[model samples]
Target chain A: QKEVEQDPGPLSVPEGAIVSLNCTYSNSAFQYFMWYRQYSRKGPELLMYTYSSGNKEDGRFTAQVDKSSKYISLFIRDSQPSDSATYLCATTTSGTYKYIFGTGTRLKVLA
Target chain B: SAVISQKPSRDICQRGTSLTIQCQVDSQVTMMFWYRQQPGQSLTLIATANQGSEATYESGFVIDKFPISRPNLTFSTLTVSNMSPEDSSIYLCSVALASSGNTIYFGEGSWLTVV
Candidate 1:
């Protein structure tokens, strides 16, 4: 099984709708969870980061982690067309430089 | 945040040829990583570059296929040797900032299409 797993979603959502992107990991040693946003032909950009199990809010985006279940999520409120991009989830162990990434979920917010 | 710049932003190379991608960071950092992202796939780490030492590559990656050079804290290069169509992917350079809790940041990426 892959260390990190995510749905390869081309999820289409309307503007102003709430969007939820999630991932599950098989490694319990993963202590840090991150969400990255990537546009077509561009590099991945760090969107949200969380350590351990907890919830972190950054503006319109919220990242939640559940270590018990090895699940992580990124919630976007009032989604916009500009938010259309591929969202990737990454996990890493503490003090490790390498990160395990999910295949990524493609999202498109329509007008 | 460290500003990473990669050379040859986009290139189309002939099969069996080699190409070297350069990465330069605005601030000096101890650790830099090279990653490859194929079409519709997630990023996979190729190797870790540390100044004054040989790069450490991950499984399935070898020094001969993807040799790395870290001559300084802020500059590094990755050469994709004897390329093939399977080598066509976006190569990204990333830096780990110790000051920022080891948060890794990536460059604009070099898009290579091996024909």
Candidate 2:
């Protein structure tokens, strides 16, 4: 099984719809969870980060971590065309330098 | 925030050749990392470049294949020693934030296409 598994979705949603992106990991040692947004032909930019099991909300984005289930999720409210991009979920161990990444889920919000 | 400048944003190289990608940061940082992103795949770490010491390579990657140089805190280079169609991918350099905030910033990335 892949260390980190995400839905490889070209999920299309209309503007003003709520969108959910998620990933699951098989490694139990992973303690840091992150969400990154990548535009076409560009490097990824960090969007949300979490240390452990909890929920964090900032503006229209919310990140949730369920360590017990080894799953994490990102919720986007009021989705817009600007939100169209690939979302990658990454995990890392405490104090470790490397990160495990998912294949990424592509999202397209149509106007 | 550190501003990163990567040279040769895109390149086309022949097989059996090598290309060196350069990454320069506006400010000095202690640790740098190199990553490879194949088409439709997530980023995979190649190695960690630490100044004054040998780079720590990730599993399945070796210095012989991807030699890295960290001559100073503000600059580093990763040379793809081999040219293969499979080696065609995006190469990126990144540095961790100073506050121990766990935030890593990446450069624009160098895209390599081998034939």
| lDDT of candidate model 2 versus the reference | 0.92
User: Tens digit of lDDT per residue, candidate 1, span B9-107?
Assistant: 999999999999999999999889999999878899999997999999999999999999999999999999999999999999999998878478889
User: lDDT score of model 1?
Assistant: 0.94
| DockQ for every prediction shown | 0.76, 0.71
The 0-to-1 C-alpha lDDT of every candidate, in the order given, reads 0.94, 0.92
Residue B110 local lDDT, model 1 = 100
Indicate the worst ten consecutive residues by lDDT in candidate 1 chain B.
B97-106
lDDT of 2 by residue, A1-111 (tens): 999999999999999999999999998999999998999878788889899899999899999999999999999999999999999999999887688899999999999
TM-score of chain B of each: 0.98, 0.97
Docking class of 2: medium
List ranges where model 2 is wrong by over 4 Å: none
Residue-level lDDT tens digits of model 2 in B46-66: 999989889999899999999
> What number of clashing residue pairs does each candidate have, in the order they appear?
0, 0
Shift of residue B57 alpha carbon in model 1, Å: 0.6
